[model samples]
Target: MHTAEELLKLQPVVMKQLQMIFEKDRVGHAYIFEGGKGTGTEEMMLFFVQLLLCENPKNNVPCGTCRSCQRIKSGNHPNFHQVYPEGQFIKVDAIEKLLNEMSKTGLEAGRKIYVIHSAERLNVKSANTLLKFLEEPEGIVTAIFVTQNINAILPTIRSRCQHIKFREIQRDVMVKTLVDSGITQSMAATVSMMTSDLEEAFSLAKDDAFALSRKTVLKLVEATFKNVHEAMLVVHEDWLPLFKEREQVEMALDLLLFAFRDIVAVKANPEAMCTYPDLVPTWKDAALHTTFNKLSAQLQAILNARKQLQSNMNKTLMMEQLMLNLQEGKSFV
Candidate 1:
């Protein structure tokens, strides 16, 4: 369980806003917490809920030992309600039931809070039904809509609530968290740049396959700058074998993109932080030989390959084309 103070590091602005709202005793009836995953939107939501439900809060922070805090922590809070997508969509039936519950008296005395996770998954019917409830909130109620993709949510629903955007967790914080968990600094630096999720970062940090993928990406980069033929050999001999799945191929492309980015960063400033800092000497040499325009083109090629890969393009062909693009600083596709 993360204390409000501990969560402050993850989202200072959001936390301060919530604390002010509580301090002024002006908590809104509805809100939309929007941000990417691992940005602490959910954690802030839980913290805010605890603030509202906790019978005894010190400095507007929930005491974790309190009954309300423990119940909320254990997912057994009576007044706290949560709605999730049943599968692919949050259908009308689930919204109807939740609305029905909201209409009645609360299970406890004070404010009743309902949080809808993956708000983008709400179908038209469910969205409209929820929109009606947002239109005229009854009793002491607060509705929080949480979504990674805010644009997917209905504009009408969005307009009804205060929107709080969560920033991506800082890289240094992520790196420290990973390093404290026993991940090597080099691997932590690379993994931290790849994702903001602590759980996913930890899993990848411990994964041998992920380590090998990083090595493969570096090898491909080296081969590309040396000789096109050699790069193609690396692809056929190594990349294709390791990144057989579409997701893995996409990850490989991301890694390749980062390697080029490191070179560009080195070109701009010799002391710049790098995803692959251990290869700074090689990156500096490549930087000395390349221009910004070439680096930009290489990055675009990698991005274009990623986009094409999502379109169900042939993975092997796409990678081959990408290698040629990176080698020549021009696209052949």
Candidate 2:
């Protein structure tokens, strides 16, 4: 039960939004929470849901002792429904059920809220059904649709809902929270620069999984220019970690991207840049030139592969191919 301020950084503007909703009581039935992926938009939506469903709710928070709050905390809240992707997208059938539920008088009255997380994944038929509910929503039905990209959503659905922008909760805010929660100052700073990505922040703070994976990435990279058995051992040690978190997967990809960038930098100026900057002296000028073009294509391939992940593709195969592409241009010395 972290404070929204701690979780979402308690930015003045976003706080003002809650105040505005409470003051005027004009909060729309449907709200579109939009922001960068991995920025805790889902967490923010959950917090808001808690506040609304809490029985003895104060200005912006729910009194945890209340019956409503207890049910929500216990995952037994009757009125509050959370719908999300089943596999890769929310189908039309799922949307229909919610629409039918909302069309009723009110399951429990005061406010019946539905959190449709990642609404962007909703298909065409599903979206149209949602639009109908938006057109003439029942008295107390409140729907919150979340997405990383609003432009990709149907314009009809977009127009009906109140769009709430969830921005990058400032790195300073995220860093301070992490430090308060027992993370060290140096590690907090490192994760923040990597992006206000929540998964990355968590991975950086909890070293057991992520640090091991990073060690694997480094070993594999260094092995191509040094030792093979050691690299494979490193990869096996943290292989399970990669399957655990999407942020870790993304971070691993970032490492590959960084390696590609290093190759580019080496090509552009051999002495100026290297993937593992400390290892610049170990690299030969001829070697950097040899893999230069291959690095460029690999970078593009990684980007293309990242996009492919958004679709209903096979994750294991996609990631395997991606890792293979990453190792393509370089030779094991």
Candidate 3:
């Protein structure tokens, strides 16, 4: 669990606005948090709820050890409710039941807080039912909606709530945060380029398949730089077997693209943070021998393979062509 102050640093603008709203005693009945994944929207929502329900608070910060805070921390707070999509969408039945619960008196005397996660997954019927509750609710009701895409929400629903947008985490900040969490600098740097979300980056770094993909892609690059025939052999023997699935192939291409990009970066600056820091010496030698034009064309070949993958092109042929293109103007000496 993150402290309110920590969340504030993650989302300064949203935190400041929430603080002002709390201080003015103008807490609204509905709020919609809009942001990409790993943007701290969920954390901000929890902190906001704690501020409203905390038994003791000072300067708009909830006393995390208070009775109310403890209950909320344990997720047993009677005034708090959460709704998530059951399948493809949030059904009307779920909304109807929740609305009924909200209508009744609570076990505690305070505001009733309900959060709907992935609000965009609400079906038309359920969305309409929730909109009615949003229009007129029982005493001290607060509704919060969390979504990655706000445009998918109903216009009427959007009009009823205060919408807060969460910004993407900075790359350097994400790298440092991941490093502090005990992730390797090379892996943290690599995943940072793979995704903007810290949660997703963590997931990737911990995944065995992702690690294998990085290793295989680096091996392919090494073989390509050494000899075109060896690169083709690796593709048939290693690459094709490991990256058979469509998504797997895409991830492999991403790793390959970054590997070439590292070579280019090394040519310009020796100290550049690369996805595969272990290969810096090898890439440095290749960078010293290769022309930028050849490197750019090699990059373009990988990109073209990505585009061809979308068209359901034969993966084997696509990769073979990319290898040939990458081998052009190449010299290890």
Which candidate's TM-score is highest? 3
Q: After superposition, how far is residue 257 of candidate 1 from its true place, in Å?
A: 2.9
Per lDDT, what order, best first?
1, 3, 2
| Model 2 local distance difference test score | 0.67
Clashing pairs in 3: none
- Tens-place lDDT per residue, model 1, 1-333, is 566766887788899999899989999988899989778788889999999899898897987788998999999887888999998999898898888887776477788899999998988789888886777777678999999978888887887889888988889888887887799988999999889887788899899999999999999999998899999999999999899888898888899999999999999999999999889999999999999999999999999999999999998899878888988898655
Question: Could you arrange the candidates by TM-score from highest to lowest?
Answer: 3, 1, 2
The residue ranges of model 2 lying beyond 4 angstroms of the native Cα positions read: 8-11, 104-106, 208-333
lDDT (Cα atoms) of all candidates against the true structure: 0.88, 0.67, 0.88
Residue 142 lDDT (model 3): 92
TM-score of each: 0.81, 0.62, 0.87
Residue 180's lDDT within candidate 3 is 84
Candidate 3 Cα outliers beyond 4 Å, as residue runs: 123-125, 268-271, 329-333
Cα lDDT tens digits for candidate 3, 1-333: 778767776788999999899999999989999999899999999899999999888999998999899988899898888899998998888898888877776468879999999998888889889887798887888999999998998887888988888999878788888888898988888899999988899999988888888888888998997899999999999999999999999989999999999999999999998877878999999999898988988888888889999999999988888888788843221
Task: Give the range of the ten consecutive residues with the poorest summed lDDT in model 2.
Answer: 324-333
